[model samples]
Target: MTWHGRPSRGPSASVRLDLREPARRARPAVPHLPHLTASAIATWRARMLNEHGSARVFEGLARQFEGAGFEAHLVEEVRGFADEERRHGVLCGAVVEALGGEALTEAPVGEAYPEHADDATPLESALRNMLSICCLSETVAVALIGAERIEMPAGELRDLLTQIYADEVGHSRFGWRMLDALSQRLDDEIKERLGDYLEVAFAHLEEHELAHLPEGSLPPPEGVVYGLCSGPDARGLFFDTVEQVIVPGLERHGIPARRAWMRRHGGAGLS
Candidate 1:
């Protein structure tokens, strides 16, 4: 009844940042906007601060995965993610630095994992962590990406988003696929528990901090969901994948593929 791909185990060796396609480069700064455009500056800086904090949380959670006896590959992915975020922070800060500033060193994520993780049995702790990553954060991530596209029309901003949307689909898929894998081992009792967990997690994403970025932006509102969520082509691809592939895949493992979940969560399986 937990989220998937935040795998507990993976290799411990250092990971190289070699992507078949390189990670997006540090973008050339726009010459106009005279001085630091305060709105864009604050919006981006605030977001990067959150990213650094989320990365820290992921780093800690990765260790917890190791302690729980998951494979080394999970640790390796975690390390890789941590490194990528560090680089993201660096690249993002370059823009700030261009304006004569530096990103704050690193900020801690404001929340704490629940007591169930510390005091409960293995199954319970695992469920807690999974719920935290997959249901809560991953869902929020997708929404934010969609929202950012609508609000920030800057080329650099759009480019950054393209990279995130591509990578994050995989992360979400991992968590969801993991959950489907788990459903195979359980009875209906567990299914109900999982359904409840997903329910609450989705509800959390509905709250204020996550609903969208604070309203103002540079290019004016392009409608609520960037081109991705709000457009036909992207929506078609998202729905086609969910209906044709992800939902079918989950159904194979005895997980219910509620059409509502797909629309709300997107084809959230391993994209």
Candidate 2:
């Protein structure tokens, strides 16, 4: 199945999420139902769908890890990541209902995962996806959610954001640690291929973030209480995370990540 990129299916493609849980578990308390505007309800509903999509992505990554002969522990961790994303979906779905929105969304299509390059080896292919999903995407999630958590009032919404933030940190760390674990196998050829793929990955990252996080708009204080944030803040945090965190992390592993990022857009970074 495709690991990322859900093509738009319009409203006809919408499906209601199953929110029933047989096993009882304590869920985060959501205390702001009255504060949730229609816009916030829509945003949380979209987040529920996004979490579900992320679960599918991690499921594919788990299979990729296992097929590539990665350590059992690492494969297990990826599987756990999938489960966590599913949990996040459920959590977000509950919040959607609490905020007076239906937990319905367009389902993503299933297909073979895309290759980073035609001639890329299996290990290279897996690493490229990992770098995209975990290193860049999840890392940016940590930054964005962390900022949101701090700005949010000490309430159930903040508590929920904290939980998600912690999971994202683990996901981000897994990418870098897995890279370290496979360091010996990253021969010069593989490093070069990964470097080349970084350009493509960075480009995709920019497109994805720009589409998800708009620019020049900040949620009002009331909106922040409902877990909203500034689009411009998110955009700036994304580039800062890329430059300060991801580039340096990749460079430490002998990948020409900075160079690849510079090449991501005609040697001029995003405005």
lDDT per residue as tens, model 1, 160-216: 666665555555665675666666676776555544454444444333232232223
Query: Local distance difference test, per candidate?
Result: 0.47, 0.74
Which candidate ranks first by TM-score, i.e. highest?
2
Q: Which residue pairs clash in candidate 2? A: none
Off by over 4 Å in 1: 1-27, 34-36, 99-101, 105-109, 118-120, 146-157, 208-271
Best-fitting candidate, scored by lDDT: 2
Q: lDDT of model 2 at residue 182?
A: 81
C-alpha RMSD values across all candidates: 10.2, 3.7
Which whole-number lDDT from 0 to 100 does residue 139 have in model 2? 88
Our model 1 lands, by Cα RMSD against the true structure, at 10.2
For candidate 2, give the lDDT: 0.74
Question: What shift in Å separates residue 3 of candidate 2 from its native position after superposition?
Answer: 16
Q: What lDDT does model 1 reach?
A: 0.47
